[model samples]
Target: MKIDEAVEIVKPHLTKSRFEHTLRVADTAVELTDVFGGSREKIELAAVFHDYAKCKPAEEMKQFILECDELPNNLLDYHHELWHGPVASVLIDREYGIIDDEIKSAIYCHTTGKEKMSRMDRIIFVADYIEPGRSFPGIDEVRKAARYDLQLASWMALRNTIQFLVSKNATVYPDTFYAYNELTRQINGGY
Candidate 1:
């Protein structure tokens, strides 16, 4: 589906602020695609729908996951933010017939990134964290890194995420550990 159509479908599900953030992420994703050499269409679509399940009632999201058999296994153990990405992926595919592998993978890994992310995944992940509307402590640095080096920005963001989760005593999803390890490996010349 087109970006406009995806936005229209997502509009009702998000708060006004989140809807605007989605637009910024889509725009950012497109820009990153041009710079990073990925399919602009896929990046745009993935960014537009990355948070499609964000505003869903937690109970409802959990119930949907319980009912859907194809949801990822890692999501089943940590059903909090862990389910958001995979659930959003399923919803975007089922509701909008968005079948592009790049787009789907981007959405699937947007929340808690994976090892060896694709260009589209990096774009969506960084865009979501460093979008214009974001105002976190290290956002400016992340935004700058995103412009110069997508992988570096992602690694920093993942590090910050893991630290934040640890501070809050929040459950760290396995994917977050895997993502951090993968990025650290890349940074350490393990590739």
Candidate 2:
């Protein structure tokens, strides 16, 4: 879908603040797409709709997660915030006319990430975290890493996420750990 169509489709589903953040993420994703090489169309759509399910009712998200066979059951056990990725992906794929597997997977793993993410997936993941709406410690470094090396940026972002979660005594999903390990290997082993 075109950016304008995607925006019109997603804007009503999000609050004003959330829509603005989505726009920023879309812009950032497009930039990363240029730097890292991915479909700008896919990046913009995935980034704009990435958080479509973020503000939905928890009971609704839980029901969708249960009915959706593609999503792992463990997603229901993670922090509720993590549900948006998979939920949005499923909903968009099923109803929003977005049939691309890469876009769906990018949205699916945007929060926790995954072991092997495609270029669009990596772009969405990092763009979401380092977007202008986000302001966390070490984000600057991750942004720089994103510019230089997306895999290194993924490792850095995962490390920062793990540390943040650990500090809060929150659960760190296994996929995130796997992503960190895989990215580490890729970066260190010169993959």
Candidate 3:
């Protein structure tokens, strides 16, 4: 699907703030794709559809997943925040016929990230975190690091996320730990 069409489809599902954030993420992903030598089209498509299932009611998301026999067992225990990205990926693939692996992977990992992330995965993850509309603490530093150091920026962003989760006493998803460890290993290896 085209970026605009994807935006239109997801627009009604998001609040004004989230819709704006999505647009910013799309634009940021495009810019990062240009700078980092990835696929701009894939990045934009992933960004536009990344949160496609985010605002769905919990029961609705669960019901949709239950109706689909091929859904992953890994998704069974996800709470709302953890479920949204993968659920959105499945919905985008099924509903909009967005079947690109890079795009799907970006959407799949945008929330918590994963080990051995692709260039597109890193782009989408950083774009979502450092998008212009996002205003969480330490975002400015992440955005600044993104301009010159992709690996460092990813480490900072993941670190911030881990710290935030710890502060809130929120559950730390396994993928987050995997991503953090992978990123830490990369940084330590002088990447």
Q: Pick by TM-score: which candidate is best? A: 2
lDDT (CA) per prediction = 0.84, 0.90, 0.84
The per-prediction tally of clashing pairs is 0, 0, 0
lDDT of 1 by residue, 1-191 (tens): 76778789889989999899999999988888888887787788889889888888878878888888868555667747667778888887787677777788899899788888888888899999988888977788888898889999999999988888889887788877898898889889885
Cα RMSD to the true fold for all candidates: 1.6, 1.5, 2.0
Error of 2 at 44 (Å): 1.1
Tell me how far the alpha carbon of residue 15 in candidate 2 is from the true structure, in angstroms, after superposition.
Answer: 1.3
- The sequence of per-residue lDDT tens digits that candidate 2 reaches over residues 1-191 is 77798889889888999999999999999999888887788788899889988889889999988888988888878888899999999899888778889989999899999998888888999999999888889999999988879888888999999999999999999999999989888878854
lDDT of model 2 at position 13: 84
Clashes of 1: 0
Pairs of colliding residues, candidate 2: none
Worst 10 residues of 1 by lDDT: 72-81
lDDT of 3 by residue, 137-182 (tens): 9999999999988778887888999999999887777888888898
For TM-score, candidate 1 versus 3, the one ahead is: 1
What local lDDT score does residue 11 receive in model 1, on the 0 to 100 scale?
Answer: 94
- The best candidate by lDDT is 2
